[model samples]
Target: MKPFYIDYPQEKIAEHQHAYRCLHCKIPTTIIFGLLENHAKDCAYRIHQGRWTQLEASLKPIQKHFDEPHIDEVD
Candidate 1:
């Protein structure tokens, strides 16, 4: 899964204030100072992050199957 980055403007960053917007949910949060805060606990985008991990885990078998070498059958 791709990492999520804060999309606050340059001026905001220069002023030490940030407005966090979730790319997936399109929700805008209040202005924050300094360190970045985590997304809302109930945000669907946040929930999807966990799902992405599960999805990758579930795909591991399929990935491995394609990665393994196959031998030709002889009659």
Candidate 2:
């Protein structure tokens, strides 16, 4: 899982020449700090992504266990 959420949609803040924010949550990128939880509780992007993250985590497959091949097995 990504430790930060920097890929959310963003748009220029109205009347602010150098400010931007999340399109769905309207929270400033600076405030969000690339963390999904920083978004508003009812934010569309946050809700969608939060569910996806949880689902992915729950459905993640376990790694397969295996042993290394012996040196004598080399062809």
- The TM-scores of all predictions, comma-separated, are 0.33, 0.75
lDDT, candidate 2, at 28: 94
Report lDDT (CA) for all predictions.
0.48, 0.91
In candidate 1, how many Å is residue 57 off? 2.2
| CA deviation > 4 Å runs, candidate 1 | 5-20, 23-37, 61-75
Best by lDDT: 2
Q: Which residue pairs collide in model 2, if any?
A: none
Question: What range of 10 consecutive residues in model 2 has the weakest lDDT sum?
Answer: 66-75
Candidate 1, 1-75: lDDT as tens digits: 445434433222233356444544444544322213355566565666667667988887653345544587454
Write one digit per residue (lDDT tens) for candidate 2, span 17-45: 89999998899999999998899999998
Question: Looking at candidate 1, what is the lDDT of residue 49?
Answer: 61
The residue pairs found clashing in candidate 1 are none
